[model samples]
Target: MASEILSTTDCETIVKNYLNRNDFEVMWYNLKPFFSEVNGFLGEHLLLLIDVKIKERTTTLRFFTKRFPFEHPMQSQYLNSMQGWQREIYFFETFLPNLERTLPGYSLDFVPRYLLGKPNDIIVFEDLTLRNFDLPRKPSLNLLDNQHICLAIKALAKYHAGSLAYEEYKSRELGKPYRLYSGEEELIKEPLIRKEEGFLGYDWFKAGVSGLRALINRVYKGEKPLEEVNAKFEILVEKALQLMFPHSNFRNVLAHGDLWAKNIMYQYEGDSSEPINVLLVDFQLQRYNVPIHDVLLFISLTTNRETKQKYFTFYLNYYYKEICNQLQSLNVSPEEVSMAYDEFLGSVTFIMPEIKIQGALQRLQQCGNKDFYTKLLGNKEEFIKFVFGDKTPFALELFDTDDNFRGLLTEAVEEVIESCLYPEIFREDCYRILEDTLGKSAYELKQYKTETIDEKEFLFKLEITVVIEKNEKEFKFLVQNKPLGFAKVIKKL
Candidate 1:
């Protein structure tokens, strides 16, 4: 294992090494960023696989990583996975390739290749250009249906099946216990509360950072409004970090610490009948977390009624069923899924209200750096506007991160399982309704050829199912060349 810390220049050198020789030619070098508001270690920047040329071969690749960042040196690293940070890394580095080789041909979907160089927290993987947005950072352009939700859940379960059996599948190759976040992040070298006031948010240039303008006066004085609330929010944030470790016992499983929709990929196959594959990207954030983080990230990030209503339950069931099927295929006794699920996510629901689904999604979609710069003088976007000609996109004053609705959804998923356990309870009418919505609204659905298996023929093809319009009342948004409405998912060949 070539495990030594790398610097920014080293990352560039390594990329050039790979590009100049066998597989690819360097086209564009993009710098990945981290969000200061969030965890420091969390990688917001990933190498965008632009063009590859090898052995008389040329190809194009694209996959996006949501720009999560770290603001100052004080930002603390945290975990959102069920198994926590430690397990997250373990699953990806250890479980991924091994599961593909072992386990009777069961597979998980994530970006194909990644680089583990130091310097600005770099991770590189397959570009899911075909797939739509992950729930968090979706530009309000794409729409998802029940099936889309289902496949996402299926992807989740398949992930669990591949990962849950880490020890049996390929434990020896599991280098360095790719578990919850333990490594130190250069950016976040300190804690939250102890940081200097100026580091809290950006200075109030246009309007300035909220919460703390006068540090000694307010922080020491115990400002009435924020003192109690800030204290509690900070505490919950820590709990959010701690929640990653579900059980100290079964610490071997792959967990996508940040499993929000932004990380999900959708290949629009133009056919509603075929099973649409949902692939994952961004692995630097991968760590040992409780399974619930995946579930929570997926459901909470993607289940905004804005995107699709009632998908909360739709996706949960999908994961459960897929997990069981994968186990059966691996001869691991399908029933063990419930036990695994139980192990990963029992006794932990309603931990804290999900930050409002939309608000969280917006945060997920944004780059931590822009969020960082905005805070410098306060108002990241406005700061950008101050710096440049175009103004940056800023959130509405009414944005809510309370997570009250998130809490509801979390409870609903865990409790609703009993009511909708049977397959019949899964709605056929729902699928029909989505098909109609998408079919009627599709201004033009273009099927794009996808090469699934590289050697022989195009493996999995996708159709660019871009819906031109939608019901404004249903899914509201401002699009450049489209109407308003919720987009549906159909797998028709």
Candidate 2:
């Protein structure tokens, strides 16, 4: 079936369309699988290395081809549900072209140049490897240096800024407001964060959370801080689902929802360790959300704790400044198009907990590679099922024995406790919510307690002394709390 899809005739058609001419003859061509099993989970990738002749000259061109892996019957249904093929087709054919036209003279080089696409099936891109852009040298694909981080942030900022510019351009041209996925079409209406079934659906997400909890429990067993964090897994899962979807309160941009190290390619100059250009790939999880969604995900997953502690503020400020520069280049005011630094920082703080949880889960999922799983579990299909089917024994085993995995998982829980749970901003937000709900000006948190109902549920009881005008009133409430703050006041006591 894949061969049929990329037959000689089909390849010629793709090439002709890309070159804008039918006069060329296909002299020679070769197709080789691209990426390893670890990186090729969603699609069947083929490097279409070809040589063609036209007007007495032979030209070589490399195109990266990706098609829905229908051959893997087990993953086909799941992949289809993700709508990656459809979304990527839309991005290459519709979204990028619009952006290119709108932001003329602005560099839209962060993404690979689109060549051709087949709706719901296959797409083609100019292979960036041929352009000297390659994945980071780190075997784990983590960006260790500040220069790499800076380049990534710059590219991301430009991409977000370009999306805003396109929206403004469309709004002016059509004499109305415009945004990505604003239309009622089925392709755009499909959500990546599906509650029922899909790659990032409730089932898969719960499985990840379950795996992380089991791993933490087994490895850290009676440790109090980790135990507390583990207790919040249920709440974190729900909170993550809520935070991942688009929120209306913040300034939104078309985010490359998956921005981890693997999806990014960098170009280097001579023998220098620093990169000159950063190119982003994989647009399947692209969504219209606040820019911080992508930024937080990238920083959390790609860098370790020390890098984050030393350079987190630097990265944030650099990204924000780049966004402003990009907006100004497009003749749009940064203040009008972007969130203020404080508000942006608040959004980051609000979403950090969910992001950390997601980073851990993503790493857990990545552990289900063919080499690792097959060697340990013997059956790849069964291993995959266990990884995504709300089973965790295999993942727990990996976490227990694998030093790198243990380190990453341990760090995630540590971050969740140190950076997410105990932050002053988090506490302030909790108190602020209580104040708003009770119509009080201020609240002194007298007692804050967490009750674990079962393995999958939690309740937060807050006893606060409310300052009503000049008087202090004591009250109790059963608060449905998220990591960000109190979700709601369930009842008053």
Candidate 3:
């Protein structure tokens, strides 16, 4: 509803201070707040969908805002040029009360309860938009259902078993809150993806993911400084010695890190042949990395094993049978449940195109192959010799010669190489771990063979460098041409 900078007597004194001590009240004629506009990059996230009554226990109060981190300005310069997404709602209210006191079969079945915010920029909660939960106004991933694959494999083994029981029983009460492709939230998502660049919309093809990226500036002119991607993610937390729990526990736990089935939510138990009550709302990107990077970015960008291989082989055998029934409900054996499903199928990454966005795959080749998205967007003879700004003036007759838009331009470059989802299982294990550790100089890491998110492990114009020098006593590693352990470093100096 356009945008109302809070009011209705400040939404009736923030819904009468959470309904004056609680039997629930707020109804303001089915309150609504759903907008993907204001040139979108997510702002006005005071989370609402209100309509509550209680006493009759007609529950619903998902008034989330946990918001208090503002300093704004954005609508796209590529995408999310940050402004602390309410610091991921204060890292899901300081990691959901330590994941509801460590998973009793974890259940957050649909956001509708979490409120507290006001000191300018309000906060509220629980409002599943007054239910009757519809979904199919363009739903995909074969509209999942086997009780939404047993509540998304019981919410991905109760979120990697409450991040393996909060990093094996509370490590400094769980830390490392989301976003990390080398942090400061990738310098505020990179100046709003360069101010929403070639802009792509039309509900950007919903979670069926036809969206794209690769807008490039050598991925914004040679990145190797946020103090070297946080000193190579702080050298994968000092070569996995211990205590660094969330770099997405590839060995077990932590990695909701933004999985996409459009951040899932479902209820349909009665009408849809029962049992699809799986619910998960965005935990503002819970990171660490690899639970197969949220199961192949939520089964290759939202859903299609040609359109549901039984909700992707029943949520990949419901996380290899709930990490073998949580190591037989923690009696633990069978070699620690086959080493936690072989580190959960070596945290699956054949390439990495989860739900599409390399500048929405070169703006769909700058709108249907304007010559390979103007040669992966370096710009083709001034995007086909100057026509400027929003790129049209018959966008070169959309690649003419009597066009039909040439077979949807080879079906949008075979779905932008199936959204980089299989570039031959990440061209031999993430290009031999990025040229055996960030070698081949300071930029130029290929293997992006597309069809969609480079079938999972990705690369292109990857400029990286790590020149170290010690002397008489310790450190020593010289000469760079290419191929070496990409700075996953931690020198302590």
Q: How close is candidate 3 to the true structure, as a TM-score?
A: 0.28
TM-score of each: 0.47, 0.79, 0.28
Q: Model 3 scores what on Cα lDDT? A: 0.39
For residue 461, model 2's alpha carbon misses the true position, in angstroms, by 18
Query: Over 4 Å off in model 2, which ranges?
Result: 1-3, 7-9, 17-22, 35-39, 173-176, 183-192, 197-200, 219-231, 269-273, 367-378, 417-493
Better of 2 and 3 by lDDT: 2
Residue-wise C-alpha lDDT for candidate 2, range 1-493, written one tens digit per residue: 4466666777787788778899988887777788754346678788887788999999987889887777666556666666777778887788777788778777667888777777667788888776678877665765357777788899999999998888777778899877775545445443545566544455677777777767656655333576566556556666667776556566677788888887888887655556788889988877777788788788877877656644565677789899888888898876665466656665676676667777777777653434675564456567467656765776767666777776776766554443333333233344445645655433344323333322233355555554455677676666554433334556776
Across 1-493, the per-residue lDDT of candidate 1 in tens digits comes to 0122234344344555434444455344343332234322343444344445556676554433333234422222222211123333444555465777766666454444443422244334434444432332233312335565566676776776676555443433574343323334322111211223343211111121121112111223222354444454444334333443334544434455455555565665454333356676544344444454566555554443333333443454466667777777776664343344543333223222222222233332232333444354554445434322121233222122324322433333322221112111112223223345554422322111122322232122222323345422222111111111111222334
Ten-residue region with minimum lDDT total, candidate 2? 446-455
Whole-model Cα lDDT per candidate?
0.39, 0.68, 0.39
Candidate 3 structure quality by residue, lDDT tens digits, 1-493: 3134444445445556656654456554233444342211233444554456667655544454433324332222112323234434554565556666654554444344554544325455544444534342233332343455455656676556555554444433355422223344431122212223353221222211212111111122332243343333223222221321323333434455444444565555345634345456545435554454556445444443323322443466567677556645644432432244434434443113322332223223323433444342354344322222233223334534424333333333333333333322332233333434544222222223222222232222222222323212222222111121121212111
* Highest-lDDT candidate: 2
TM-score of 2: 0.79
The list of candidate 3 runs beyond 4 A from truth reads 1-95, 98-100, 103-345, 350-423, 427-430, 437-493
Model 2 has an lDDT value of 0.68
